[model samples]
Target: MNVLEFLDSPELTPGTFEGDTWEPWRAVLSGAFGLPMDKGRARLFKRLSGGRKAPTSRVRELLVLAGRRSAKSNTSAAVAVYLATIGAEMDGLLDKLKPGERGVVGLIAVDRAQAKVLFRYIEGIFDASPVLSKLVSKRGAESIDLNNRVSLEVHTNSFKAVRGRTMIAALLDEACFYADENSASPDVELYRAIVPSLATTGGLLIAISSPWARKGLMYQKWKKHYGKNSDVLVVQGGTQDFNPTIDPRVIKEALEDDPEGARSEWLGQFREDISDFMRRDVVEQAARVEPLELPPCADTRYFGFADPAGGGKDEFTMAIGHRDGERVVVDVVRGRRGTPAQIVEEYAALFKDYRVSRITSDRFAGSWPADEFKKHGITCDQSAKPKSQLYVDSLARFNSGQVEIPPEDKLITQFCNLERRTARGGRDSVDHPSGGHDDRANAVAGLLAEAATRPANIIFECLDDGYEPEWHPYQMFS
Candidate 1:
């Protein structure tokens, strides 16, 4: 039986869905899969159609873009389980597996907590069904083993974790926010890693997420492939369109407070508040394939800048660089998290190693940074401008190809994700997207800005103090 039918069966939900509890989803998926729909649903389908008609062909891939509380996670979990079970009856799903190999159905989420939510839904569905439950051979915190040699696994979004698996199907939940705490490009990296594995098995890949920024793999796919008549299907809808059960007042309050965010979260539109400040291609073009870590050179004068965090949630980052004639060459970048005193002491030692005379820092913790550096006999100069200005100045260097960046993935990700926001007054500012960090980028910008703008420290002295030269208009002209 199909997933929607199974959901309505007596063994599963019983009589919970009476009239049109699932009618919207039924129409959507029927159109997606090219199955016949009832007249009412068919009309709804036509109204919701995008670039092409609902074809009579099978869909090989699907991308569902919907608002929050729109039954996306539940629908994704149901579809994943269906592919792992009912779809298994098809040829080549289990036929290609070796004697000791097992087919896997993967459920990936933005984080561990989100992954667990979907895993629980899948687990509950299996445990509640008598027929489906008989296939269970083992169950763990994040995986379920069936007697038929198939495994259902749950994981946080990561390319390394998903590699080498022979998947029957994979469900990516809330994929727009797939970035981990430390990563900047989780969506692209994870997607690229999983696609090759699917090629061998012809497994279905479903990415369901609420609309986010106008970038990343989700946005790119929708921009390029949505409404196209192909194996890939991109479905877009708002909260009311998909799940009318959500309270209208909840969405109303959200819209009244922040219209842009509300539209992205509840209306299923990409945010106008979010965009890239520096293009990814520009950043990549300027970065070295492999970064260099150089020891202190006796001839070159080095400089350091720190973008201090409280050492709590954010990172305590520092950048070290030197002016190479007209250009700034970044030598090293370091970040650590700890108590304020501990971080200060660590940076003190690093400063001594580079023979740094003075360090520049943002005004973090008021006068504490200056006071703490005093303990180490180092002068901490607070920047006159905000971090946004630092990014703006650094952007010019990047655009002119004057600065060569290190090959740090985190640094590159931060730069790529940085957004240039223009307020209603025509004032502009640059910063990272929500849940992202720009500590490394900030530190580097500070270091490069000083290098580009600061003049060389040259002390003038007179060797011929006893002699004075005569000044005349004719002699000066000659």
Candidate 2:
């Protein structure tokens, strides 16, 4: 089949594709992969084949959430080759301006070396196959150009370089890892910046990777974009779903061989990599079982905090706080799963009784509860950043001694168990350590964000010159 035929193929498999038509170049790629040239391969091709769709391309933003070792890389390689051919074959969905009007297509990874790996995969694939090999004009580790109009260039995860060059399409591989590296990342800044080149001019963005830790731009977007956005297509397959080489029995054996690797590579999890960030031990050290002393005469601004979840086993956490100038000390109020009504009544009562200035929580999957707070006249909004970021923000303050938490604070126990998970493309996440206290971690974040902003004054009359630090963790959650 002609590469241009694959690039401009109009033949649609009636029920297979919903968005865009097939690019002829991609059809050639499917044939190479032994994928039948029929509707049957439409889902697989969209999932495994096309790059950001060109004029005849089917997808716009490709968000693939496959599991580890699921042939994600191999499938990704096929798409790269397809794009290279399209770029080489024609104007790449650009105007039919004679020829050579379209600029270069970008293949980005975490670094130049990794980018070369993908570039080389496509290069090698074409070099091996007679049909694909013909399109290969010049091939190297960093680049593969076809005919004249199209060029496939590999790049490290540098948003700057990516932004500088114009393109018909761009592919982001190992999204989870890059997201890890994008902490305060200019690269991420670049991704947001470059969206217009396509959104305005009609180009494509392909983001494909197994998950890394659960923080940063990719995770943040993945968390939100998949369910809500119409333009985004999120595809996921476990090792069993996408992996071509690994057998089910062998996969099970591999999991048994190394439970940690199994959790990360196959399950795309970050549990094993997290722990040891919070100053819980310090809180514990500062804790003491003091008597119920007389109350201080000065007024205090206390805040009851909560961390909402999007279900699937994430916790519903709450914390009550009192601000003393720079620091707002908090105690865990409640952390569990229940109806919005249950959560609101408990936190509201705590807020009123404690006279907390406000109540805050993460704006995630808890629509009903967050609304419930609104109905009751409670202040509520989503955390501006990820839990990891909030964790970092709070930790930075605590480390500088800018914030203070007595050992007796029940919330500190939850903080101590937080974990930083490993993500694809070198990203990491800060969550309650596996089987630890996420609710506690989230509550602290709420307290921290509130403190940094405009806050009420505290008339600090030392209520307890000597403190009582006896805190029972188990009973406190209730």
Index of the highest-lDDT prediction: 1
Worst 10 residues of 2 by lDDT: 469-478
Candidate 1 runs further than 4 Å off: 13-19, 90-92, 180-185, 288-291, 424-426, 457-478
Question: What is the Cα-based lDDT of residue 47 in candidate 2?
Answer: 43
Which residue ranges in model 2 land beyond 4 Å of their true spot? 1-57, 87-102, 129-141, 179-183, 199-201, 225-229, 253-261, 268-478
Highest TM-score: give the candidate number: 1
* Model 2 accuracy (lDDT, Cα): 0.55
Give each model's whole-structure lDDT. 0.78, 0.55
Predicted candidate 1, C-alpha RMSD? 5.5
Distance from true location, Cα of 133 in model 2, Å: 4.6
Please estimate how well model 1 matches the true structure, expressed as its whole-model Cα lDDT.
Answer: 0.78
lDDT of 2 by residue, 82-138 (tens): 655653344335453235454566777865566767766666566556665665677
